[model samples]
Target: MQTEEGMVQDMKVLVVDDEKLVRRGLISMMPWDRYGMKVIAEAMNGTKALECMAAEPADIVFTDLMMPEMSGFELMEQLKLQYPRTAVVVLSCHEEFAFAQQAIRRGAIDYVVKNDLETDVMDEVLERIAASVRSRADNRPEQQEASLHPLFYEGESPVRLHGIPGTEAQLMPHGDSAQQASAEVCQALWQGMRWLYEDESFEQLLTLTAELRLPQSQLKDMVFPVLLKSGYLLLSLEHSLRWISRLEQSRRWEEWREVLQEERSYLRNLLFREKHAAEVVQGILQAVVYMHGKEELDFSQNEVADVANMSRTYFSQSFKGVTGKVFQDYVKELRLYKARQLLLQSSKPIYSIAQQVGFKDEKYFSKMFQQQYGMLPSAYRNQNPLRVE
Candidate 1:
């Protein structure tokens, strides 16, 4: 059923067949609601289907073999490469076994003969396809859930262990033993990320965890995805770190060590369930650090907008939305915060601290600090007693 807001609880389907009568019958007769499928659009041929795909995203395609402009084979190839998320099902006559075989080989999920097109068959096909699509919905971390089905057999790496019992290894988690093993595997993944980026001691953990009886190869396979995902995460994180390097010079590397420690859980979660969100937040933090480190760079909202890869206007809005402060205000407050810390902690002159926080003149920095904190830099240092670290 479709809601008042036009949100239909149906798997979006694109039906493409050259024969008008067949296409119409399939679209009109199929119990789409029952199978949780919605015939969002119909195409007379493969060419038309491709055109529609660009405008309307479909969860699956039910296409005919013989078409005028483009054949089912061609369409299936395009769909497999381009819209991999959208599954394909070939629709040809029963005698066209060779065509159906070819379609299946080309990555069509299933094939249905035109003469043998029973409602039950279509219902079953749609149900299965809907299940596949729904499984990928962004609810939790994606990396942790590997399908138990045979389809993933080709994609998975061979399982091996250093001190395990069985020669033939299975990747599927079974009981409490398997659950504990999987947790250990996840911890290894976290360790590997730290090893690669933060230079954390990971080899010791790997050598010590051999008592888990996991196949060495299986553990390697599990660790592989985390390594690959962390590469991208590291690139985005490093991009932000570049900006931070300019903000403060004292124990700069140590500062990164501290910040990465704080954000490790967020990064690991990104490596597992929410990679893109992690990248965005990493970039944001990097921007903050960069602005602080480069206390005298004269950076502007537009520059930051460009760095964040957002439109100047949208960047401003997102900056406020995420950080709860306008971009300029956030930058100023950040700089002032750094300036205040320097004032109390270090014997660095007020002018030097002001310059270090990105202000050209000490007077400007002092005035901004006073307006923000209701006190001059010297006065703040005098009133607020520094806590010994």
Candidate 2:
């Protein structure tokens, strides 16, 4: 987004999102090179984004709303004051339309729904956004409240599943009131939620719930409660339409059970075996996913935790519980793993490889490499050199 003189760089973009996948997806959604657009940088949160912009200002920023330490709103507010020329575009979930509206009022030039993005939809959005940037129609006020239409959505609204995060649970088919769970039954059901809220496996949770043998409608109602209590509500609601389809099609209890069984591995990966209960697990989930997506896991757990809006102690504990490994250990392992891959597959120098994977000291990287593989990086490359034809 660096300007040659005073004119803005057309479509020179920076993406900010806690989730690395979403950030990468937005960047790669179109072939920027072909369109004279460049992805300036990718930042995990607004704070890092500001630093990136200060070093090399981007013409436009595509940021998400619910980040940890620095939310998109805060970032935009800063942009309005510090970098007024830089166009701000919000990337949001459908349910966050109200927040996006507020962002528009503040100073965002435009917004796009993350949940509804398709290649074609993204093309139209990018064109519109780029045009606005080129024309310098900066942060124009909306004539009316921005409303979401089906054209901007790919599936049924998540609200249909449980009406946003903190509301009362809804029954699928209206179970009999008399048959509704009693205090004791509800308490017992709540007790069963341990299989979910705690870091228990999906199979274990399903096994416990299956034993209860409640009516299908009542049982269906239990899903949201379990997810709500587990801090998996937002994650689940993000994929609600998919699960709701299964719930609707499965007439029998067994069918419903089968649907859940299919999702076991995915759900299992999402849960930690020793859950540190908090209202929001998105921070933990985002941090883990963000780390995995990177070739160089350079940042500290504290940095990631801070960006995710969790206490360092809590983030460390929750990360260990969810991933079954300490954060530093996990990062070390990932770094070494990538270094090993690069050593074997890439012709880059050993020191270069080490630095690329985030080790500033080549000797330290070599020591870790030798410790991990029983040989130094150079030795490993010699043993397993890859020749590209």
Candidate 3:
């Protein structure tokens, strides 16, 4: 385990096993300290492991398959379903290949046999697992460059001022200047991510902030938090738009609408470029917003192609590629989402609600509703009548 004085400070690991001898052997054999990992806790059984996890969560788990209770598989299942952020690496002396395979299925990041334990293999697994962890944390540089990044404040444009291509940004803050840079970077990342709903270049805004000169150690800290905050901000914005649109005060709503509008405008600017995938996503979102609540609208492939100003074949391909769904599916999902809102908030009948959300036939609407919500529209309405306004 790494000591506090020289540790990377980011890597935290947990070792769980029934056999104390084996646990101590594994811990003593590995150069865990060199790898920047610290053994935060040890547990003799699955139940104890869970307690340890709740008390001090570790980034990685090394567990033995056989234990007095709560075997490795059960612990892995609990962790996978609950604290999915923690990666599991299972171990066992038993020559049962099925046990390892099952571990993989349960979302264990990797499985290492006790018999196969070697310095080289352990190193390889650790490196691969660490890389995977980092990748899942944020979009790659290329992805960030392609997305639209919006600045929230009305004053100086941070991207324009700091993104001069040659400037080296600090990853984290150390002194007063570095700390200020970190704050600025975080703010820019938050605002840029909001704009990313419309445009894709939001990463440049963060990069511009990160470019402030700071120590290498501080810089690493800055990157992960910025990425994390960006994701949180995006999720919050999405939830607000979907569930609490009217709950916002008028002043707050006006501010929200203005930010959304600026984001949309920034995306439109990106779309003119015609070459970026962000532009393609921007175009699709524009189409989605335009069709919202238009009962008379029918989103044909040809119409979408025309709206996006591309061939039907190319448009369909790029639309699915960028959004991870076919155009038809995307439209259907959007309509269902809106319909759910209307059903919960308005006193409209099922047929009227269907028509309001672009479904012409009540029968088709009911069928689609059943497919999405697993209940008939009438039953759904009866169970969840509109809230009194």
Candidate 1 per-residue lDDT, tens place, 95-207, comes to 23234335535655555656656776667545554554454342223443343323223333334544466644344454456647655665665544444322234433433
Candidate 3 per-residue lDDT, tens place, 72-151, comes to: 87888898777776778777653232343355446565555576667777776566556544543332334432322222
TM-score of model number 3 = 0.35
lDDT of 2 at 233: 25
Against the true structure, what is every candidate's RMSD?
A: 23.5, 18.3, 16.0
Q: What is the per-residue lDDT of model 2 for residues 38-64, given as tens digits with 9 covering 90 to 100?
A: 897999998999999999888889898
Instruction: Quote the positional error of residue 82 for candidate 1 in Å.
Output: 2.5
**What value does the lDDT take at residue 49 in candidate 3?**
93
- Assess candidate 3 and give its lDDT: 0.57
User: Model 1 off-target regions past 4 Å?
Assistant: 1-8, 119-122, 135-389
Give Cα-based local distance difference scores for all models: 0.57, 0.61, 0.57
